[model samples]
Target chain A: MKKIDICLTPELLHLYELTDRIVVVVDILRATSCMTTALAHGVEKIIPVATLEECRALQAQGYISAAERDAKKADGFELDNSPFSYMQEHLKGKTIAMTTTNGTLAITRSREAIQVIIGSFLNKTAVVEYLRSQPHDVLILCAGWKGRVNLEDTLFAGAVVDELKDEFLIEDDATLGAHTIYGCAKYNMLKSMASSSHVKRLHRLNLARDIEFCIREDEYQVIPILQGNALVAMVKA
Target chain B: MKKIDICLTPELLHLYELTDRIVVVVDILRATSCMTTALAHGVEKIIPVATLEECRALQAQGYISAAERDAKKADGFELDNSPFSYMQEHLKGKTIAMTTTNGTLAITRSREAIQVIIGSFLNKTAVVEYLRSQPHDVLILCAGWKGRVNLEDTLFAGAVVDELKDEFLIEDDATLGAHTIYGCAKYNMLKSMASSSHVKRLHRLNLARDIEFCIREDEYQVIPILQGNALVAMVKA
Candidate 1:
């Protein structure tokens, strides 16, 4: 039987050998959600860079860039960490060089995996369909706040595990924890996540709309797949 | 306002500088629960050693000892990681040297905290009552399985947060995640933990009854305090 494991945070990457596993990287609060939204709206590709310098260097090469940190847009970046920011009409067919505090770091750290697929509540079904088609083991890796585990990403991981747990063995306590949390919050995602640290933080910064947008299920049907340092929408056959 | 936080793993001890926080260490699937059961049964003090050598050294110096690893009793040890084993008739007024995989490591790593109190479902009410009287910030630290985060500890941490969340400002996503899980599992503790990795592991070893005893709420009013090198049941005045 295929196994389903959850690495709750990128810091736990050392715990698993990711030789042939399909890694689904989730940052549901905004990063992956934004990437999914961008791809759904016809954005060509997203180059997720780990550092601000790399994003800036890519921007100098004429690619549009966005930067975010501590729930705010970094200086000198045209866009911040909002799903709506990535939905601009001009962004259609334009490649984006993006850097965020959590998502970009997770994607960069997980570069060694066989396949790294972007996961978000916005694109859950598409990602799930892709996972069902794969013969390899699936690992839902949450891109937590900085290196510590966060609530929103974990809830997303749990949601995926809940849908596909019967098909594979639930590997660890962390995975079970995620599945349990998903059971609790699956009924009302918005209300359940209202008190989450990231949601609460963004609310304090008057970004409540972003939280609502990020957690909206099936908002995007495209599964963003990493190919040669860029994430582009790919339809699973 | 006072703040409430939860560190789900001992590996996160470095992320927190516990200068003014009342640190409550919870190892709910057995260690802290065992300590609580022992104290409630009138055991004098527990010398929690992180390493087998330290436990052995303490044992050699005229103290009863118990050693546990990977959900099983270690070789040459008279006792295992069950709460019922500590509820012995002969254990009254006796000191013990103990070493376990997760709990002892958390207790050792949290040596820098201002106050370290052992927490379990058995002593939930007493721990909460004590926290209510404390002016310092509170950090519920879960001693997870090995260095990885676990479901039961996080659920226990959440249960504590659920009670005290209104009184204090929750600090981070980890805390929120814990609180959410607690909200999910509060009504049916056993059912919620039925699928956890550790519980299933112990169940396979025929330790199903231990799981029942460990999750019993407020079974004991004794809160074990880490005083110098020993854990002694301390009643809050």
Candidate 2:
């Protein structure tokens, strides 16, 4: 039986002796959600870089930059982390060079796994469906905020664990913790997390709708897998 | 108003430019609990070292050794991480040279903070009561298993947050996540954490009693504060 584990925050990556596991990187508060939404909306490829400099440098290579710093659009970047921005008509078939505070950092750090992919509430079913097909043990990697654990990411990680709770042999305290958190937040996520620091911060700044849209279950059905540093839609034949 | 934040694992220390805040280091499985118990039971002082070598070296200087590695007492050490083990008749008025897998590591890493203290379910109220009196911001640093997040430590961190939720300005997602986990586990800590890996591991080894005893809320009322290189009971005036 394959075991399912989780690294609730990317900061814990150094503690894991990761190898041959299917890693699903989740950043529910906008980054991975945006990436999932981008693939679902027909973006050609997403080159996820870790630094703002890398996101800027890629523009020279004909990749349109979509960068974020601390939940806002990077000062000079052409795109913010909003899912709605990924739905633009002109971005179809174009490659996006993207960087964010949390999501991209997790993607770069997860290169050691057998496979790395993007996941969020927006594409929850697609991710769960795809993982249920893979034979290897699963590792849900939460791209927390700037090297710290965040609620939205933890909630998404937990949600996936709940979805696959019966299909896999859950391993470690984190897997169980994520499962417990998801159960508490699934029915009324916004209400459950009304007091969470990130949710409260974003709500105060009037970004409540982003949190609202990000938690919508199964809104899109797409799994973005990393193929040599670019996230492309994993199309099943 | 002081802002209360959390670094759930040692890996997040870099993200926090910590200053002027009191850091409560928690290793709820057994270590911090043991330290708190040792102090509550009138142990003179505990010199917490991060390695087996440091603990062993102190034995030659007349300090009794207490060391654990991979959840068991280290070879030739005088004691393991069980809190019950600390309630010994001979342990009173004695200074223990202690080292554990997670607790000592977190204490060592928390040197940059204004102060570091030990916290566990055993000394829950003592820690909270003391924090309520202090004017400084509080940071509950969970000493997770080997730099990774663990169930018991995160739960203890959450308990502290819940106790202080109304009094402090909680600053991050990890803080909120901890509080939520605490809420789910408060009424039935053992049952809520039955599926967590550490609990199962200890149960298989017939140490279920230790788990039950460790989660007993406010079982002891001693606050162990780091004084110089040793953790001594903070004498209240």
Candidate 3:
């Protein structure tokens, strides 16, 4: 069986030894969440840019622009980091060039992996199904906040491990650690992470609703795969 | 009250707005453990260089050398990563220049903090005493394996939090998360983490004894402090 592992943060990436694995990038609050929701709600595709300048350049070339830094919408962008922002009718059928604080950087960094897929709680089942079909080893890349392991991403990894443990060999301690954290917190995630610095920061910003919404499992079925510089919904071959 | 936090891994480090806090670095899987033991055994001082070349250059100046990478002794070095290596009579009263895979890199990255202290389970009480005397905020830096969060360092952080919780405010979710992890595994740490990738790798190399020795509480009472590019034990003025 192919080994399944979890990298709790982008900084733990060197341990990835990423020569042959298919890396599933996750940013549960709220980059991948936003991407999944965007595609599910009829957005055409997301071009994940590493910087605001790149996002603006894509806009200059006629794509709809969205940029977030520190979890808030940048001054010139049309949408914020909130998944709710992507649910609007105006976003439907439009291509978005997006930049985020942590998630985009992770996607860019894992470009060298055999394949990079965006994983979120919104599309958990579909992601698991796709991984089960692939022949390669799987690595869940949690795009932790600024290179630090945060609860939401690890919880998502845990949920994935919980779903796939029967089909794959989970070899890394981080994988077991994530599953343990998920098992303990899955019942009432908000209460479990009420004291999380990221959640508190969101609460401070009056975006607690975003945190609640992001944790809802399997809300969407869109499995996003990196194609060139953009993430397009995976189409079964 | 000063905010105190522990980053369970170097990947989690950037989450720290490390602008003005005192960073206490802990790498129980030997670097910080070795430093604590070296000081406790009456070694005069420790110079932590980031590279083996620097250690070699320091050794050329007549300093005794101790260098390690991936938990093994460097070629031609007098000491390996094991704390037991520092316990020998030859190290008594001698200045040693040292470099290791993770801990030294963490200390180097944390040079910008208000203060940086090397911490391990061995020197837990002395570290708490020092923190009690200082007025600055504190951040426990876990020099996790090659920048990933490992079990032993997080456990050590939990031990410190358990000790100093009355005086310092635990302000971040990572600290709470680490404390919870420690609480869950306190009674059976060796068994709980026997499956860890780092531990397994160590076991493959016959270094399980080093892991056991590294996690023992209060094995030493010496706290290593960074002073002008080298880590030396603090002397009371």
Number of the predicted model whose lDDT against the real structure is largest: 1
lDDT tens digits, residue span B44-160, model 3: 789888899999999899999989888788998878889888888877889999999998888888888988899987888889888888888999998887766777787788878
> What are the per-model C-alpha RMSD values against the true structure?
2.2, 1.9, 2.8
Q: Which segments of candidate 1 are over 4 A away from where they belong?
A: none
Q: Per-residue lDDT for B1-237 in model 1, tens only?
A: 999889988877777769888899999889999999999999999989988888888778889999999988888777789999998999999999999999988998887788999999899988998998889998888999877888899998988888898899986878877787788778888998888888888899998888898888999889899999999989666
Provide per-model DockQ scores.
Answer: 0.62, 0.74, 0.44
Model 3 chain B: ten consecutive residues of lowest lDDT:
B8-17
The best-first sequence of candidates by lDDT reads: 1, 2, 3
Tell me the tens digit of each residue's lDDT in model 2 across A1-237.
Answer: 878888878878876666988999988878988998898898989999999999889987778999988777888889998898999999999999999988898999999899998888888888898889888888888887767777777888888888788889976777777778878888888887786667776776688788888888888878899999899999785
- The residue pairs found clashing in candidate 2 are none
lDDT per residue as tens, model 1, A1-237: 889998888888877878898889999878999999999999999999999999999989999989999989999988898999988899999999999999989888888889999999898888888888889998888998877888889889988988898788876888887787888878888888887778888998999888888888898889999999999998665
Native contacts recovered by model 3: 0.46
What tens-digit string does per-residue lDDT give for candidate 2 at B1-237? 777887778878788866898999998888898999898898999999988889889987889999998889899989888888999999999999999888898898888789898998888899999999999998888888777778888888888888888889977877777777778888888888787777887888788999889888898888999988999999886
Q: What lDDT would each prediction earn against the true structure?
A: 0.88, 0.86, 0.85
Top of the candidates by DockQ: 2
Better of 1 and 2 by lDDT: 1
Two-chain DockQ for model 3 = 0.44
- Docking quality band of candidate 2, CAPRI definitions: medium
The alpha-carbon lDDT assigned to residue B155 of candidate 3 equals 76
* Model 1's TM-score against the true structure: 0.93
Q: Residue B219 of model 2: what lDDT?
A: 85
For model 3, chain A alone compared with the true chain A gives a TM-score of: 0.96
